[model samples]
Target: MDFRAINTIVFAFLITMCSFGQINCNCSIGSYLEKIELLNTRDSLEVFELSAELKKTKLEVCKFKALEIEFNYFITQLNEEKAFAVLNELEDYLGRINCESDLKFNIYINKAKYFKLHNNYEKLSEFAFKALKEAEYLKDSNKEIEAIKQIVYLFTRMDEDDKNWQYIKRAEKLIFKQSNPIRSVKNFRWLAFEYETKYTRTKRKPLLDSLFIFANHSKKGAKKYNIFDELALSYRALEAYSYHKGNAKNALKYIDSAIFYAKKIKGKKNLSGLYISKAWDHLDWGEKELAVKWMDTSFAYDTKDDIAGFMMHHLDATDLYEQAGRLDKALSSYQIHSRIKDSIFNTERTQVINELETKYKTELKDAKIKRLNVLLVITLLIIVSILLAGSVIQLKRTRKKNKILKRAIEEQERLEKELSDVRGEIAQDFHDDLGNKLARISLLSSLISGEVSIKSPNIKSKIKQINEDANGLYKGTRDFIFSLKSNSDYLEEVVTYLSDFGGDIFNKTEIKFTVEKHISTNVKLPYYWSKQIVFIFKEALTNAMKHSNCHTVKLSFGYQGYQLSIRCEDDGIGILESDLQSLNGLSHMKTRGIKIGCELLINSNIGEGTAVILKGNLKEDII
Candidate 1:
């Protein structure tokens, strides 16, 4: 075949395939829609059959867009009275896929209505709140209104009048802005119910007035099918208010109006409530037989499963039978009353127990979590304590080692100082007494050798040489002893020694020296301590002379009150920054100053001259 003919055939084949696929897709979607329609119409058996078929078809299609359309249809089906079918479908759909916001909201609304019909008030209230939140997110006003109405109804049934009033007000505000007569009338009716119920519970007159106003508003231009029950309830509330106010005639008149409106409604079940109201009025007026007759008629008319009204009727019958002295009838009625009362009490107790169980489980869970946290903290503390104890033991061992090393160093320093002092004393003894005696002996030997020189001229020359060498040795020893004994003095003597020493040093450097003495004989040891401090000053000045390349130095000593101060200054190149960390010369000087109970301050900078200050508090012995 040619290329053009082949292309034409391929195009036609593709179109046919596309058409077949569209037909199959539409058929699958149609099947899902038909199943939802049956469910919405309350055909539960057919819904179950169709739902199974749809599930198979969905697997065959396996498309998300098709699934979404199916979900939307399921949401529509959920709005109907056959809610079990819808809930089953919803559980499947929610399990399979996520629904759109509008679809989810519709599902919640349907679930809330279904729960209300089942008399599951707690679930009804919970779903109503859920629907309200979804409706708010979708911004759907009708859904919002419906959800609010359901919430108000649930709250009223549960006897939560405060919450009932709050939702009722919200629904009323929404209804006021809508032009729909049916919705507006419904809102007004609910508002009237809220006010009447509040009045019944609180016996407040203002609530009765509010109920009448809303009832009248609801009946305005409304069809007969609407507003009848609300109008009757409003009249009954007014009658109750009148009864409370002691206006018996007005109360009877309003009760008659209540019966009239209630009878106008087509249903006998609806009319039973009016009969009960009339029986209450008769019983209040002390007509016991008439009240019993009305109550029996009311019971005959009550066809629906109104448990509260049924219980109340039996209770009233028992009361009336007792008052009439019919003991047998009274016993039978009382038995029925007791049965219903027990049922209600048991139901309330079950609800309370369920709530308490839930609370207990929650508390148990919180207690477990708290216990775990406490255990974790305690474990951490124990671990930390062990680690801290090890660290403390190690630190103590390190401190003990450091103390032993420090004591050894101090003992070595003490031994070295003692050895230095002993060597100085031995050198002084050789110089002072032994050297002088050796010098005298050498002179006497020289004289004896001279007298015998005529006999031995050679011996005379040798003797003269020996005498000169002995004299030189004697002079060296005398200078050594004099240096050792130079600083040994009492207070007054030490002060005199420092003045002479400082004057001699200043003369050598051509610097000035000034001494101010406060030497009391009582200050002997203090003055002796200052003499050692003078050695520190001498070392600092000698350092300045060697390194400072300047000519002038000044030394000053003074005492004021209890303090003695010595200052030595030099106008020379000061200490270098690099030499400040050295521990040899300046450190020794500072140690000497500290030994004498002095605080030594060295003020020096590069090229700024040096000043050494020694200050100490004089002892009381000196004072």
Candidate 2:
């Protein structure tokens, strides 16, 4: 076994034990998932480094992610035993976590892929069937269709026409219902590859036509979705079809297009392959010089660090150089290819020998580890029980000691009541004094502006601004009083309070405003909920008057059972699709809704109307 693979598995187990031993980690699972996905996967050392990071997250889900990445790395290196070990670890993790259906389906799919890698058709078919069942149970159409495609690909490889076509039609039925035409791109590519091979062998006209038709279907779907990855592949297939059909111009053109898209995606793997195909097309068209140039370009894209890529590049280079009559270069390429091939074979043999030698020792180690883990869990349970018992004892003792303080508690409650009364009185006095003074300032400014408008035009503008400022100050003073003084904690109070403000404000506007409420009983609400709702309502109403050329606006409040809903709607020239995205106050309203833990949505269409709807659950705390 590779030491890295063994270390990775051991570290993953440590993370599992730590995460389950503690109840919470203060780390967001979603954020950790995003961070894990962004890590470099092209190197084994980076994957090993992820183990230390997983300790920070202390999440079983992170362990699963690490193991999956390690599995893919081993599989890519053709380290079959290590890959199988990782798969077994994954299966164990599934049972340990009592995993979700999606994770279970993922495990089954990985099993199918693993078996396919080993050419175990029987096992592949078994796991594929399991995945299809799991996908159906999960009620995910995309996953179900993917599983069907896997089975279809399996039968395609085995040359089972009946079973292949059976699954294909089933997948197509689901595809039509899904209505995402791009999903068919890979399916069409599979059929095209299958037919193209048969056509190459028999030169049958029907097979040739079917090959081109499926290739074109793939191309159209890929282009429609702007899926550059699949579009590059589809064009490569088209290039092959064109070459076989003896259309030199179209063949070369399609290869160039494939290269263009592969570059767009910065897909080194696909780019290297496409460059090789372009070289072959040129060589077959009797342009040996251009073929040599293209083959050299492919060498630049194929990274030297990738053993498989390096080996394949040299092998192809040998063939191309030999065909171009460059005997010396061809001989050098063949020598390098032979050296790499032998090195890979030797490495595999050595790893296999070491794996067999460690088999018994590994099994013994695993059994001991399992026993240690069981003992650790039992120890943790005992410690937790002890802590909980101590907490209960302390609570009971405190309650007994507090029983003799009843007289003091009663006196404290009396003081609290008096303090609340005094606070109310201070709020009322502050509002009355400042509000009257601001109102007097507004009245004097308005009288002076009326005389100045006829006598001095410039001074009239200044006086009018002073009158508006004074009125604004008065409104601000009243709102500050409301905030400082409100003691109501009921949804009914909020509805009634906002209702009075709406009636007064709309009376001054040409647009009609109406309030409808279905609040039955006084539902308990937190200050934060009521405050944000009031601000959101005011912002929506202001926007409607300024931006929406509306005849009437309606505000509705509703509370029934456990649900609370509010809507601010306007019968105006509704927002255009372009302008709706840039609607001012959208982010502000959304932020407010988020703070109150509510769902907020804006719906509109041209010439119809606009509606801002908010909904949330009334929690059990509302006694």
Could you estimate the TM-score for every candidate?
Answer: 0.37, 0.38
**Model 2 regions more than 4 Å off:** 1-59, 100-102, 172-234, 241-246, 256-276, 283-623
Candidate 1, poorest ten consecutive residues by summed lDDT:
34-43
Error of 1 at 473 (Å): 99
lDDT of 2: 0.74
* Candidate 2 TM-score, true structure as reference: 0.38
- The global C-alpha lDDT for each of the candidates, from Candidate 1 onward, is 0.63, 0.74
